[model samples]
Each structure stands twice: as structure tokens, then as C-alpha cells.
Target chain A: MLLLITRTFKESIRSILRNGWLSVSTISILVMSLYIISVFFVFTSTANEMLKEIKNKANISVYFKADAEEGVILAAKTEVEKMNEVKSVEYISKEVALENFKRTNANEPVILESLKEIGGNPLLAALVVRANNPTDYQTIDENITKATFSEEVSRVNYNKNKELINKLNSVIETIQKIGISLGLLFAAISLLITFNAVRITIYTHKQEIEIMRLVGASNMFIRLPFIFEGIIYGIVSSVVSVLLLFISLKFIASYVSLTIPTVSLMNFYLANFGTILGYQILLGSFFGVIGGLMAMRKYLKV
Target chain B: MINEENIQEEKNKIMIKFDNVSKTYKGDFMALEEINLDIAEGEFISVVGQSGSGKSTLLKLIYAEEAATVGEVYFDGNPLSVVRKKNLSAHRREIGTVFQDFKLLPRKTVYENVAYALEVSGAPDEEIAENVPQILDIVGLTTKAKKYPHQLSGGEQQKVAIARALVHTPMIIVADEPTGNLDPIASLEIVRLLIRINELGTTVVLASHDKDIVDKANKRVLVLENGRIIADYPQGKYKIS
Candidate 1:
């Protein structure tokens, strides 16, 4: 069987090479489907990565009582830091908050003088708590309240920003879920189209297959060539898909990076070159074997 | 000789047996009926009949290409009627089939066409490289081994088909109007090739309508008409009228 398999592979490759137009047509179809799927995969994954970055930028800021001492807020920061869900805790002192306020409002003279007229820092000392994941905020915020210095806290400022974060999280999640579902559906459809293309090509050469069968060729022996043809189809198409992707991304990607100001397709594809190649090869080979097996079914039987 | 065949008819020594074999197409038109025949090993025979007669049907039945409505066809020791589709390849490998159309793979060259049969049987490259050229030479196509099917003349293509048929060196050769497309000279070339092939001690069962080639063979002939074997002779002629 192993001997037959190798022979089939060699013969299949030979057959494809001999049929110039056939080889071209099969490879192009395979490449087209693979390229479409790869593009969809890149788009959704990049979007997910960008969304995660945005989530990491968010935090819960708890403003303390105006009369509360700075030491109490520092204690609150330490307590929040010790909690399992808390990713990080930073205490902003009243003076620091006042300076930040003045710096932010420097362009507005009325607000700046009003701030000087007070002749004092009129800001509350606050602790900003960051959670490991978006959903972790609820648990960690509750832990902040159960701490010994809860009286010093005027309110947990998380109450203000919590609703906005929750809404944003759901929106991001929904987009990812839809992207995944659509990606899978399209991938399956693409695979089927690729398979059918190979099947049709084999059907066209059915006479050749039957002749091969009649000559005393084993089923496995005859199947090898088809499988090899499929692999060749897969490799050629994946290379085409990748090149088309590269050139298109090379042109359209710069424009996209300029408009979006987030992801750089060139850099991403470059950074993940090995991963992309590995993925493309695996995809091409998988589709090729499947397409070949399915297409060669009739010929392999008798 | 006929009496000797009849005495051994009930025994299992025959290589092929058609027991009450019959075939009818979609309509009630019977293509073949009550086809009881036994072929001994290494016998070179020809089946001669008119165009609509059951000659081709008998050949197809011997290969089990069509099922008989009433009986069974036994090849070697196995019953073809019940042989699974998966086992068809093995069964077909035991018999080389050549058609009037030649049925050579257009894409394959003469050498490749001949080697294809061996390739399917998992023969190694050395064996293919060795056997194919030799068989082509045997069919007298050694000089034209590199030519594709289109490049060759009808006689040459038939020779390639013959080469393919003989490559596996099977026990029997079932030819269905093998010379149907050829001119008289080309047809004789084919007849000569079949004769030459038969001389190698392989059983040759050809269904041909050409009067001259059948008259010249002078071998065992089975004549069928209206789906029945109307004549059996040690030597026979094309009785189309």
C-alpha cells in the first residue's frame, strides 16, 4: 500500500504537470478560496486584538472624601492591590490631582485663576484600580468597599464609569462572536467550493481514471495520483493566495493604517511570517487531500 | 473433439462457464439468452456473429460488465454476478479488455498507456520501465513508444491498445469489435496482432463481424443469433446471412 501510495503521488504530479491548463485552473480556484478565508481570519483577529488593547486602557478611579487624609487612600490602594482580581492600583494625591487639573485646564484662563483664587488644592485623593479582565472589576470593586478604611471613601468612582465599560464590553464581544461565526461559515463554504472544483476536474478526466482502473491498478494505487494532484493544487493556490494578500495588503494596508491609526498589516504579516506560512500550508494541504479524496471517489471504486 | 468437450462439460476443469446466461435491455428485447458455454484453459477462440447478435453481450458478460437475467458467469473459480464492486478491479485485472475505440488514454504516450495497467497493479518503476517497452515491442510499437495517441494512426493506436491488453499478461483477452474502426489492411493488422497474441498461449475471445478475419482464424467459434448460440464448431465462418 505504501509503495502504491508513492507511485500514485508521483503519477498524479506528473499528470497535473502534463495537463497545463488543468493545473492552472485547479491551483487558481484553490488559491482564491484560501485567500478569501485568510483575509477574513486576519480582519477579525486584528479587530479582536485592537479591542483588547482598548479594554486594557480602561480603569476604575475611586475619588476619596475632601477631608480624608492621603494615608487612608494609600491604605485603600494597598488593599485593592492585594485582591486577587486587581491587576494594578495607583494612588493619586490631592496635590498631584490639583496639578493635573491645572495642567489640563492651562489653555482656559478663567478656570486657571479660579483654581488660584481657591489658594488651595481643591481635589480629592483617589486610587485608580485596574482589573485583570473587564469582568473582574465588579468583584475587585466590592473588595475595596469591604476594606477597613471604607469610611474614608466618599464613593467608589467606579459607579460613574461602570455602565459605560459594561456597554462597550458587550459591543466588543458581539462583534467578535459574529466575526467568528461568519469566518467559520465562509471557511466551510470556501472549502466546499475548492473540493467541488477538484471533483469536477477529476470528473472531466474520468475516462483516464477508468482506463487506469481497468489495467489492473489497485484502488489505493490510483488514488495516490489524485491526492498528489490535490496537494500540488493546494500548495500552488496557497502561494498565490499569500502573494495576492501580500501585494494587496502592501497597497491597501498603508491607507487602512492611516485611516484607522491602529493596526499595520505589513508589520503584522511580517512579524507573523512563519505562523502565516505554516497556517497557509496546513490549510492548502488539508483542502487538497480532502478535495482529491472526494473527487477520486468514483475512479477509486472500480 | 466435440464429444470429448461434452463428456468433460459437467466437470469443474473449465476456466470459464456461462450457465444459462441471458441479458435483456430496458425493453423486452433480449440481447442474449440461455448462453451455456465452457472454455478450457489457454484456448484461443473467437465469437463471430452479426451486428445485433449477442456476441458483444457474451463478451461483456464474461467480464461481468452486464449481469445476466437468468444465470451466472464463472471466471477462473469466482462467480462474477455476486462479486462486489470493490472486487471488480481484481476481477478485471485477471482479464484484459480491448474495445473497438482503442480506449487509450489520450494524455498518455504509447509507453505510458501500456505501463498504466502495470502501474495500477502497484508494479515498481523498474518493472514498468522494463515491461512496458518490451510489450510495446511485442505489439511492434517499440519504434513509436514516445508518440501520443493522436500522433498514431488507427492501426498504431489499436496496437497500443493491444499492448495495453497484453501488458498484464492476463489469462483471457475480451475484445469487442477491436477492428471496427480500421480499414481492411489495418483490420488485418489487428487480426494478425490478436492471432499473434493468441499464439503466446493466452485465451483470446474476439467478437468481430469482418468475414475475412473470422474465416481465416479456423479456431473454436461460437455463433449467436436472437440471443441464442445457434451454431458451435471446431472451426466456423461469419454466417451473417
Candidate 2:
């Protein structure tokens, strides 16, 4: 068994060396496919991170009626906090609201003078509520509207930003759908090309395969060499693609960071390096072996 | 009485038996018809015929490369078709095959080509290392073992084919017009080698259309005509006239 494996391995390598052009072309196709897949992986992962950041920052600020009691406003905060969708709630007291307003307009002397002339603070206490997910904001808004303290609330701010939030979510979802479909289309095209390439390779060796069969070689003994050749193709292409991906990621990391600081492609790749490598190797080899097996099907009928 | 005769025949250690064998292709074209023959152990037989005379088909049936369309082919008393698909190789290992075109892997050297036969059959590394050179020596290709098929003469390539066929020490060697690609001199050389291999106790089955070589062989000859044996001569000469 050991000798058989060694011989198969030797023959596989010899075949690859013998057919240098075919091996190169096949490996190039594999690398291109794997590179495209890895790129899409990085794109989707980065997009996902950006979406999460945007969702985490999304919130609604609900102000109380200017004449409402402070205790009632505090009660609204507690009530909103109790809701399942609400991630957190922070209360801005009347004093803090006035202070925030003044600090925000500190550079505007005219606004400061107007604020002093107005004498009493015109701000209202409000509760800022954040939801666990962007989609949950609508539910939280509906719940707040029907709450016992709804009358005391001057306005629910979620309705004002609802369209913007919905538009962002929809756009992200559309991008994700298009990304997946395009990725699959690219993969299918590459796999088909690789399959045909392997078929041609086998076609060139049709005589060799026939001779092997004539020499009383078992089906598996004949098959193993081709299978090993395919695996070598996969491994070689995967290593090249991964190394290329890593180098390109490193080269573009700083530029990407400058433009889209919310998500770092390099960091994502580095953090999941093992997983990325494993995925590429597995996918690459699967495609290679499947292509080889498809080609071998017709010829092994001997 | 026929059954009794068959029992006695089986007792004589017949290596191959064809009983009313017929092969039809695509439902209409008959490749072989009602063929019956018996080959004993260590016999050298020549099958001579024109093209499409079912000579190749007969050789194929013996190794179960092609099944008899309507009857039985028995190798060492076991029906060829009854052998499971997985066990076909084991059966073939006992029978080496040589083809007209030589069928040597162009990329592999002569030594590698011969070694490949043993390699595929899972021979030990040491055995292959020891036996390949010995076989090459027997085929008179020891000096040319390092050369590729394209580098060797037609005769040398056929010698390599014979060496590959001999490496497994098969009980029977089947050659299908093995000298078809060779010159007259090379063809004669191959015939002599086959005769020598037969002398060493291996059953040799040579299929050929070359009248000079076949007539010179002077062995048991089965002349096939349109998938039927026209004559079986104990020591035949090619009678083209």
C-alpha cells in the first residue's frame, strides 16, 4: 500500500512536469477563481462590519412636553429601557440639554447673546433610545407611541429618520444580494473553464490511460495518479492566491483605512487568516478534484 | 457423452476455452460467430486473418476486455464474464497484453515504461528495482533503457512493450499485430522474441496479418475469415494463394 501511494505520487508529479503548459494553465485558472472568491469574501466582510457600525450608532431622541413634569420624563426613560428592542436609554435632563445647546453654539456669539436675552432655558428633557438592531427601531417607535406616558411626550423622533434608516438598510441588502449572485456566477464560470481544461488534459493522455488499462492496472491505480495531480494543482494555486491576496491586502491596507475607517480589510484578513486559508484550500481542491473526476468518467469505462 | 468429453478436456489443464462464442456489435454487425477453440498451457498459437476477421475480438475475449455476445469464454475453467468487475485486474494480471502501436508512454523512459507495469500491479519497490533490469536485459534493451519511445527505433519500442508484458511474469502473453508498426527486419525480431518467450514456458498468442512472419512461425495456426475460423492447422503455413 505504501509503495502504491509512493508510485502514484511519483507518477502524478511526473505527469504534471510532463504537461507543463496544461498544469500552468489549470493552476492559473484555479488561482484566478480563488482570488476572486477571496476578494468577495473581504468585500462582504468589510461591508458587514460597516453596516454593524452604522446600526450601532443609530438611535432616536424622544423629547418630553416642555411643561411636563420631570418625574414623568424619568418614568418614560425607565419605560423605554424596559422594552425588549431597546438596547439602552440615556436621559438628558433639562439642565444638561441647555448646557449641550450652549456648548454646541459656543463659537456663535449671536446665539449666546440670544440665549442670555431669552433668560430661562427653552430646552426640554429627552430620552435617547437605541435598539439592538436597525430593523427593531420601528417596533420600538410603535411601542413608545402606545406607552402610558405617550401623552406626555411631545414627539417621537424615530419617524423623522425612518426613511433614511430604511433606505440605508435596503441599499446594504441590495449590495449583499448582488455580491453573492456575482460571486456565484464567477465561480460557476471558472469551474466550467477548469473542467474543460482538465478534460483536454485527459484527452491528450487518452493513449496513456488506455495503455495503463491494458497493462492490468486496477481502476483505482489508474485513477489515483490523476487525482493526486489535481490535488497538487489545487494546493499550488491556493498557496499562490493566498500569498498574493496577503501581499495585495497589505499594500492596499493603508489606503483603504484612510477612505473607509469604519472597516479595515487588512485587519479582517489578518484576524481570520487561518480560516481564510482553510476555506481557499478546501474550495480550490474541491473544484480541482471535481473537474478531474468529471474528465475521468468517460475514459475509465475501460 | 459430450459432457464426459468436456470433463476430460477440463482435466487436461486447458488454459483457455471458447465455447460457441459469438460477438455482435450494435445489434447487427457480427464481429465473431460461433467460435470454438481450446488452448492448452504453455502453447504458442498464431491467429492469422485479414482485417476485421475478429482476430482482435478473440484476443479481447480471452482477457475479458470484451465479453462474448452470445456464449461463454473460460480462462482456467472460470467463465470470463462471471468474474466481478473489481476482480478483472487480478485476472488480467495473469495475462499480459501487447498492442501494434507499442502503446508506450512517450513521456516515460523505456525503463519507466516497463517498470510502470509492475508499479500499477503494486509490486514491491525492491522487486521492481530488481526485476525491471532483468526483463530489460532479456528484451535486449538494457543499454537503451534510459531512452524515450521517440528516441528508440520501432523495433526497440516493441521490445520495450514485450518487456512490459513480461514484467508481471504472466502465464499468457497476448500480442495484437505487435509488429504492425515495424519494418520487416524488426517484425522478424519480434517474432523471434515471442518464440523465445514461449520456450520459457509462457503461453504466447500472436495475432498477425504478416504472412512471412506467421508462416515462418510454423506453430498451431487458426485462420479466421469474417468472424469464423476457416481452418485450424497443427503446423500451418500462410496460404494466401
Best by TM-score: 2
lDDT per residue, candidate 1, A10-114, as tens digits? Answer: 767666776677567767766766777777666656666665766677688888899988777777778778888888888888888988998899899999988
Which regions of candidate 1 fall more than 4 Å away from where they truly are?
A1-7, A14-29, A66-125, A131-151, A159-196, A250-267, A288-301, B1-12, B24-30, B68-70, B82-84, B146-153
- lDDT, model 2, position A259: 84
What is candidate 1's local distance difference test score? 0.78
**lDDT measured at residue A194 in model 2 versus the true structure, 0 to 100:** 56
Q: Against the true structure, what is every candidate's RMSD?
A: 5.1, 3.7
Candidate 2 is graded, for docking, as medium
The sequence of per-residue lDDT tens digits that candidate 1 reaches over residues B98-196 is 998999988789998888788778777799898888898888989998889999999999899988988878888989988889998998888888888
Pairs that collide in candidate 2 are none
What shift in Å separates residue A298 of candidate 2 from its native position after superposition?
Answer: 3.8
Residue pairs whose backbone atoms clash in candidate 1 = A8-A225, A217-B120, A218-B120
* Model 1 chain A worst lDDT window (10 residues): A293-302
TM-score of each model's chain B: 0.91, 0.94
Q: Please provide the root mean square deviation of candidate 1 (C-alpha atoms, Å).
A: 5.1
- Clashing pairs counted in every model: 3, 0
lDDT of 1 at A239: 82
